[model samples]
Target: MRRAAALLLVLTSALALAACDRQAGPASPGDRGRLPLAEYDMPEDDVRVVGTARWTLAKECMVRLGFDRLRDLDIDPLPGWPRRPAGTGVVSLVVYASDDFRYGVQDPEQAARYGYQAARVDYERHYREKKWTLPEYLALTGEFVGDDPKSVHGHLVPKRGCLGEADRAIHGTVPQDRKDPVLDLGAESLEQGKRDRAWKKADRAWSACMRRAGHRYATPTDAASDPDRDREELEENLTDPEYDLNQPSAAEKKTATADARCKRRTGYVRTVHAVDVRIQNKLIASNRAKLEDQRRWNRDAARRARDILADRS
Candidate 1:
């Protein structure tokens, strides 16, 4: 009976351990110093929790950066009078492969291979711009990845991006910068028209870059294209609040403009949360049904990444 009890105890312990493993998170390769974002070490769940996390965190980052939670816009000719909430965002997830991972082991692994790198860089740059504004966090960027820093070329920040390895060789995020343009109080623009024109040009350039980088164009070319279907997806993203339709740079460029704003819009940060993520339309939840389909792609992405990395490693 004592022996039987010991065996049962072992079984119970093993089951408990397994359950804990299920709840636990994956390892976070980055550091915890002065960055605007938090690096979580959660296990990759069956659900695309990472994508959800990315969306939540990116929104949180934008809120911390300045703007109120995102509002929507009406670029339509005959705009619908009755509008809806801008909805939850679409988060992109990409996982790299073995060949590319090995290449990353070599010097010069190209991030364009996985288009997600651009937005990640934008996030980091955006974080820095905002973090620096507060004197208390002046050193945020300095220790971003912590001590024993990898060479910039290393898979360190994932900014240069994942070379495509491990269980899921991808990094993820929601690109709030794509929502719209805001004033770069630190940057200098010419005429008001020139500035607006620059913003328009910059938006086009970034859109082109998104395509080149392999992102599906999220915006609909035509509102009548799919009507409800199109409206649902577009509304659930980084938005352009009227408050964000900014004016001019308040001062001269004291620091290099963030790379995230590399494509440019009338940019900079006063408090920062005010700059990056702006939404035009004020959202109201109409259906009360949380959109679940949008996350399908991200889940497929996460599973595929795990499979590819498993095969490679």
Candidate 2:
């Protein structure tokens, strides 16, 4: 039952995750952190407001359908909405607010503090602590009764549940199979950028730099993912049961710091950014119509969210 309820939570919020994985582009020292595809994606804060409104509407609908006890849960319905900078089991649900570490950890301070791990947030923990009842889950996820009508406490439930109804009210059903063009282009751009000769050259330089620093990694990504470290941790855990495998090790900190410095020294971030921007611009030009439609949808959703929030206030 717990497992089913968890699945319901995922289903309820799947629409929000379908949007985009946040905007990414080059940051030049101290700019507004704009990128080639930033204009096409909804700003992070707007996305948050929309999420809040959707949850608010869904919660209200739940009460109307007789789940009044939820009104006192006093827990945040939205967690990891805009994406936190650091956390365990990081899931990219929407566009993040900034370009910081989008191309990996560029900030030495952050690298020092977190190594390859993102700073932890309690989003996942919150969900685990607050479990929803099965009936509440059904109300949020719609009927599992096939084409037959379903009701809870004598009130009919929406086809897709209160969450789906709220989603439709804010996001609408235009472009039934909605797609996020900016996200598509951004992914394409990264692949194309990694293939660029300049990026390869910078990668080679970074690898050599890491080697000189006593850490041998073909790429910064490899160093961050660090399966080798994971293996070592697993082996060590057999002998010392107190070892927390997920925590950053001293070696990881050293490697991460070296990685940050090496990236700066080898101009890796700049190379990738330049290549990505070039590819992304070309992609945007080619997919202008799709992107425009996505932008239009985002604007409409944001407007509806604002009105909903305002009415609630």
Please list the Cα RMSD from the true structure of every candidate, rounded to 1 decimal place.
26.5, 7.8
- Candidate 1 residue lDDT tens string, 133-182: 22111111111212324323222322211111111223332112111111
Q: 1-313, model 2: which lDDT tens digit per residue?
A: 0000111112232232232211122223322245678778776567667767777887889999988887754425463222222222223322122344446667677678767654231123322233455566567756343233478899988866776788888988422245667756776887888888988888899999989989888877788778888787677676876776546677777788899999888888877887777888899899999999888888899899899999978
Residue 37 lDDT (model 1):
13
Give candidate 2's whole-model lDDT. Answer: 0.63
lDDT of 2 at 145: 31
Top candidate (lDDT): 2
Best by TM-score: 2
Where does the lowest 10-residue lDDT sum fall in candidate 1?
Answer: 1-10
